[model samples]
Every structure is written in C-alpha cells, then in structure tokens.
Target: MKKKFKILIADRNPHVREFLRREMAGPGYRVRLAENGREVLKFIYGDEFVDLLILDPDLPDTDAPALLRKLQNRLPYIPVVLHTFIADLGHCPDIFNVVAVVEKGGSSVERLKTVVYEILAKDRAKEKIRNNMQSAGQKKAAPATGGKDEQK
Candidate 1:
C-alpha cells in the first residue's frame, strides 16, 4: 500500500490556513493546521507522524527564520516549505529549516499546489532512496546476525 504522508500548514491568517488546508488535504495526505509558529512546533515536537511542513514566512509570534531553523535542527527528516508575499525575505530559508521558499499571490492556488508538490516530491524521492539503502543494509546484516542460529 502507498504510504500517506502527514503535512502541516502553519499560517497566522485563518483564511490562508484554510486555503492551504483545502488545497493540500485530500486522499493520501493527513493534514494538520497550526495558527502560529509555537503551535506548529507543539504539533511537530510531539509524536505526530508529520513528514512535510509548510511555514508562513511572516508569523505572529517569534521570527520566522529562527522558528524555521529550530524546526530544521530538531527534525531534519521533515522537509519545510516557506511561503510569503514579501520578495526580499522569500529567499530560501535554508539558513533556518526551510527546504524550499515560494512566493505567494504570484499564481493561483493551483499553482501553489503545484509548487508545493514539486518541493515535497523531491523530498519524497530522497526519502525513498534513504529507505532503500537502509533496507539493503538490514538485509546484508540479517545473515551475519542470525544466519548461524537459523542454520542450527
């Protein structure tokens, strides 16, 4: 069965969060909403199965960059996509924890979906490769660890 990935939308604006929730949620994706950076961290730091995070560059509480950085440091496995209307700060938030930075209001919601999928798709690809490698390593070690016992 195909794995369903959990995605988090963290935006201060209710309308924006709702828009993103509607766009990103559907079959094969478990969507969660967070109103601010603190909430986002709260949801993430726990045992949530979130794999992708979409962050608002302009948040209400703490600075977005710092929040993103802390997220990235704590959970490097999850890919973060930053959204904003500001062109200057739109530069890649790679310094913090953002994997991709996208500009808002340039295109329609459909376009944002496309951009978001593109970024997350890249991350999923990398994750697949990592998983495959780990699987191979486990296979190689299985004989060494249990082969003698099984033979006996």
Candidate 2:
C-alpha cells in the first residue's frame, strides 16, 4: 500500500490547529497537531516520520530561530511551511528547509493546502528519481559471469 503523507501542524491557537487538522485530514493526509514548541519537538523527534510541517512562529515557550535551527540541524530534509501573520514574516529566519511562507488570513487555508500539496508532490518526484537511479546503478554494478563463451 502507498504511504500516506504525514503533516505536523504547529500553532499556538487551538482553533487554528483544529481547523487546519480537519482541512488537511479531509484529503487523506495523516495530520498531527502541536499547540506549542515542545509538542512540535516531541512529534518530530518521535518514532513516526513527518513528511511536512506547517508551523506558526508564535508558538509558546520557544522562539522561531531556535526551533528552526534545531530542525535544520536534526532533520534538514523535512520541509517547513511558515503560517504567520504579515507582520511576522519579516522576523522569520532564513532557514534551509522552510520551503514557503503563507500569510494568515480568512482564505489562507486554501493557500496552505496548495503549498503543502506542491511540496509533497515535489518530494515524491525526487524520491522516485532517486529510487530509479539507485536501481540503475545496481543493475550496472551486477557481477558478470566469468566464462569464455560470455559476451564482453
């Protein structure tokens, strides 16, 4: 069976978290909600893998720079989407894995969904290409039989 994409949505507001959870989960994504920076760390560092992260920089107890630095050091491949107000955008750190930033608004949920889809789709394409290259390398590297009749 194909694996369902796992998304971690980190936000300070309960309503926003629940809203995003319902929206993302409706389309068959495995959604996990984090109300604070601690929960976000827990979910990311735990056993299960997360394919994408939708994060609000205003998460309590930890600042965006610190959290982003940790994420970059540990799991650089896991893409992050910053969902924040327009004012907070200027304060966002220039991190490697943060693929996009969506402004918080009434209609931002749809934009967030679209960004998530695009990032995950690109990830899937890269994975497919890597798998193909690996298989091709393996085929090329296979040991050849040593016999006089064997073609060169």
Candidate 3:
C-alpha cells in the first residue's frame, strides 16, 4: 500500500480552511486545518507528523515569516506552500523551507493542489531512495552464519 501524505492548512479565514480541507482531503492525502498561526504552531510542535504545510502569511496573533522561520529551525524537512494575497515573494527574505508561494484567488486552489502533489511526489521519491539504501545496507550486513565459510 502507498503511504498517504499529511497536509496542514493554516489560514485565519474559516472559508479558506474549509475550502482547502475539502480540496486536499482526497485519495493519498490527509488534511488538517488550523485557523491561526498559533494553532499552526501547536500542530507543528506537537507529535503529529505533517508532510506539508499550506500557510497564509496574514495570520492573526503571529507573523508568518517568524512562524516559518521557527518551523524551519525545528523541522526543515517539511516543505511549505505559502498561500496568500502576496503575489510576489521576491523581496521576502529568510525563505528556508518554502517550496512554493501561491497567490489566493479564483484559480489558486487548483494551483495549490498541483504544487502540493508535486512536492509530495518529490518527498516520496526521496523516501523511496532512502528505504532502498537501508534495505541494501541490511542485506550486505547479514552474516553467513551456516554457510560453507563457517566450516573452513
């Protein structure tokens, strides 16, 4: 069986959260919603293993960049897709874990899903390589306990 990816959508608007949850909660994905940056932080800091984060930069109670920085410091492996009104993220600094910046609007939902799929696919590829390497290492490390060499 294929592993399902877990995505966390962090936005202040309930509508946005619901829309994202609905859009991303299909096959091969498990979506989690958070209404604020605080909630996002709570989910990230907790024991739950989130594969990706779709974050709104205009979050209440916490600056998005700060939160992103903190998240990068703690969990750099997880990729982030910044879904916001900010069309251009060129000037923004400290973009460590951000994989894509998607502007919110009419067709942004579809764009978000595409980006999510691509990022998750890349992650899956990496995981496969890692697992294969581990399996190869184990095979090499296995001892020939009862082989012809044991009688020599």
Candidate 4:
C-alpha cells in the first residue's frame, strides 16, 4: 500500500491557505496549512511529515529564501516550490535549487498544479526505491540470522 503524499502550504493569508488546501486535496495529496514562517518550521519539525513545500516568498514573518534555508534542517530531502508575485524583468535566476518558482496570478493555479504533480511523482519514486532497498536488505539478513524466529 502507498501512503498519501503530504503537502505543506505555508502562507499568512487565510483565503490563500484555504484555497490552496482545497485545490491540493483534489489529487489525493494530504494538504496542511501554516500561517507564518514560525508555524511552517513547527510543522516541518513535527512528525506529521511533508513531502513538498509550496512557499510564499513574501510571508508574514519572513521572506521566502530565508524560510527555505531554515526549513532545510527538517526537510532537507524535500523539494521546495516558491510561490510568489515577485515576477519581474530579471527577478528569476537562471537556475535555482528550488524545483520551481511560480508566479502568483490568475493562472497560478494551473502552474502550481503542474509543479506539485512533478514533485510528488519524484518523491514517490524515491520513496519506492528506498523501501525496495530496505526490503532487499531484510530478506538478505533473514537467512544469515537463521530464519524469522532466531532473528526476532
């Protein structure tokens, strides 16, 4: 069986949070909300687990890049998608560590959905590989330890 793909939407606006949660929930992703930078870190450190983060750069407590650095401790393996209205002539870098930086506008929903789907797909594939490796290791060790009862 597969576990649900968890998504954390970290933004201060109530309407945005609710809307994002609703949109993300449509595709079997377990969506969570964080009202500010502090709350986002709290949820990241918690055991609830998050596979992808959709971060608004101009958050209430902190800016996007700083929050991304802070969140690295708890979700180092997870990919972040920067969601903001900071699109400008040269605001975007040629390459970024973030999987995607989406511009917030009328068509933002479709853009976000695309990035979310890509991130989830990659995360699931990595998780499956890890699980398979663990399974293979257990199987190999089971016989070396003289069967289940002895190993247990």
Collision pairs in model 1: none
Provide the lDDT at 142 for model 2: 95
Task: Pull out the clashing pairs in model 4.
Answer: none
What residue runs in model 4 are displaced by over 4 Å at the alpha carbon?
88-97, 144-152
Indicate whether candidate 1 or candidate 4 has the larger TM-score.
4
Per-candidate alpha-carbon RMSD to the true structure = 3.8, 2.8, 2.1, 4.3
Candidate 1 lDDT for residue 98? 61
Over 1-152, each residue of candidate 4 has an lDDT whose tens digit, in order, gives: 66788889987788998999988896467998988888887876777878888877666765555666666655677788878776631433432347888888998988899889988888789889999999999898874546667733
Error of 4 at 8 (Å): 0.8
Instruction: Summarize candidate 3's per-residue lDDT along 1-152 as a digit string, tens digits.
Output: 89999999998899889988999999999999888888888877899979999988777888667888889888989999988887535434667798898999999999999999999999899999999999999999998698776875
Kindly give the stretch of ten consecutive residues in candidate 3 with the minimal lDDT sum.
Answer: 87-96
TM-score for every candidate vs. truth?
0.77, 0.88, 0.92, 0.80
Off by over 4 Å in 3: 87-92
Q: Whose TM-score is higher: candidate 3's or candidate 4's?
A: 3
User: Tens-digit lDDT track for model 2 on 1-152?
Assistant: 54589999999999999999999995547999899999988866788778999999988898888899888888889999999996876666565678898999999999999999999888888988998999999999997789787986
Model 1, residue 15: C-alpha shift (Å): 1.0
Q: Which ten residues in a row have the lowest lDDT in candidate 4?
A: 88-97
Sorted by TM-score (best first), the order is 3, 2, 4, 1
Candidate 2 off by > 4 Å: 26-28, 94-96, 144-152
TM-score of 4: 0.80
Clashing pairs in 3: none
12 in model 2: Cα distance from truth in Å?
Answer: 0.9
Model 1 over residues 1-152: C-alpha lDDT tens digits?
66777888888899989988988887778889999878887976788858788877677776776776777678877777767765647443445556666677846567667766776677678879999999999898875546556655
